[model samples]
Target: MTDTERLRRWRLVLGGDDDGTGATLTGDDARMDAALYKLYGSRPGGRGGRRGAGLGDSAPSVARWLGDVRTYFPTPVVRVMQRDAIERLDLTRLLLEPEMLDAVEPDVHLVGTLLSLHRLLPDRARESARAVVARVVADLERRLAQRTRSALGGALDRTARTPRPRRPAEIDWGATIRANLRHYLPEHNTVIPERLVAYGRRQQAIKRDVILAVDQSGSMAASLVYASVFGAVLASLRSLRTSLVVFDTSVVDLTPDLHDPVELLFGARLGGGTDINRAVAYCASLVDRPDDTILVLVSDLYEGGVRDELLQRIARLTASGVTVIALLALSDEGTPAYDTENAAALAALGVPAFACTPDRFPDLMAAAIEHRDLTPFTNHNT
Candidate 1:
């Protein structure tokens, strides 16, 4: 009937724990409440602080109040809750956010929290995380912008490594030069043969490219948040080509809309049937050179379309030399709900499927770049 009542229903629908006595909620009411709670909670209480007494014997009312606010919580309120949860829960400490970040650099949401935590972190630890964040951001942007070179422009490409590009710039100069060396030689009578001479005057164009193909099904919202930030980073790369695709039964190319991560996320329809086959084929069409591209498929591997076709398409891409890595997720959570049968099928095709937090993306990219063998399933390692 009301926004509060609607949110309660949707929460239960989302597999949230609810007492199960509520009025029915239409889609409009649920959306409105979600917006409202995102803006402001129904009841007033900062995270971790105790509510005043007489609320309830078991805090049911308190939870109810929070749920009522959940749908219509304000953006500022939601942000505070996010901040508070990070603080009070001490999730960073428990999850080893700092160390995990060092091992695998995550996106802005994680970086922002760590930045907040940086105040309390030891100097060395904080510095290390910052450095990792800096590198990770740069690397991630490159991955996001797979082929749209010059997005950030000449300043990044022409710049040398001494001072380094900040936030989102990591160009592989040696690789680029070596890749284009044949063109540099004079046609008439030039025999440039020694590794020493080639190394002596090597100035390569360092460019970054990233392609983010995400599944927009219901179970992927948290991972979607990280994906949006990563999209923003990829959009920042001047030398790399970047594109974002969010799919349900249908696929939509959101590459032209990477300016705002929030908008990019809203562009996605979070819950729907999956067509991994169609999504992959669509992404394959976008790839100019599979060898130069890194295709990250963030999905549970469920196929609503033809399953055999999906596996065959993936095998084709891998054979074409595309760096196809399967990520079950990019959330703080270990592994969200996924499709085991689909994962197994793709694994058989040699597609590397793993459940990874955003923190591990940087190392994962590095490994992908080095052409190292990637493990196909996330659960196997654990």
Candidate 2:
């Protein structure tokens, strides 16, 4: 906008009073800068000259810093700074304490950190931690459950549709009338139906199978968190037989815990070596019908086990009519770090590989069910 405005923005980004922008900050701006400086320290120049910043070893200091950051910044910015404090400042161990857990903001990333440290968490803080995790899960489900069900349910019904009806109850009247609209007899002012389209009653019958093969390595924490919640939502739908298989060199079927995402998250043991081939083969064994199954592999494609066998298994899966999609990530954090070579290998075998956001996942599943080209979703994110 203006030179003054530009310099002022640069001052914030650079961090520190004498940041060489020739701009001065005071009052709220000054306090906001101090809160940032406490977490990020002073960058003085630009990138490399970063000085360390810490809120000290005590809970009071971290709590006060959290309050100041919340007062100065919005929710999203505050969450990011909190995560940076945990990672950059080594404040993760402090999170295991009850006071520290209560004084922080709750979000998806925080849940990932919590779940990763579940085994080491102090007993006193376990309840508080569960509350925080449950709150975020409930909020996500409230926003996502309806949309996921609507999209997948509609697609399932569409896929199950038949061209001929065996009885009057099975006839899709709307589709039938539209199909014969041009054959209307003007004398009788009505159309004679020659063909029938079934409305796909479904009832309690399983329409399709969906298997989520998730990687639970340390770097894939956030992806697994979102995937678990989505798996719970998908398992809730009656017309689909959904199974969730999580792996980190070994596989664990947490589908039983999918009824409660919070428990499912706790059941996941994060931060381990990855074995993509082993996991895929295990999930493959679970598949009963390849043509009617949608297998989503959520990982960054960093293979720690037989990479060649993984590619071969993927080729076989795609050849047998399984709709295979590779999600490098499933979070709001754009531009995830992934193995480009492995991604390219999967692409060569007719698999659509890319990171997908939670908001876009429902539509992605619907498109997979319809066997529609998923390039638009891939292109939009990639």
TM-score of each: 0.51, 0.90
Give candidate 1 regions above 4 Å deviation.
1-208, 376-381
Q: Which lDDT value does model 1 have at 165?
A: 26
* Residue-level lDDT for 159 in candidate 2: 75
Give the Cα error of residue 312 in candidate 2, in Å: 2.1
In candidate 1, how many Å is residue 248 off? 0.2
- lDDT of each model, Cα atoms only? 0.59, 0.88
Measured with C-alpha atoms, the lDDT of residue 218 in candidate 1 is 67
Cand. 1 Cα-lDDT: 0.59
Residues 269-289 of candidate 2: C-alpha lDDT, one tens digit per residue: 998899999999988898888
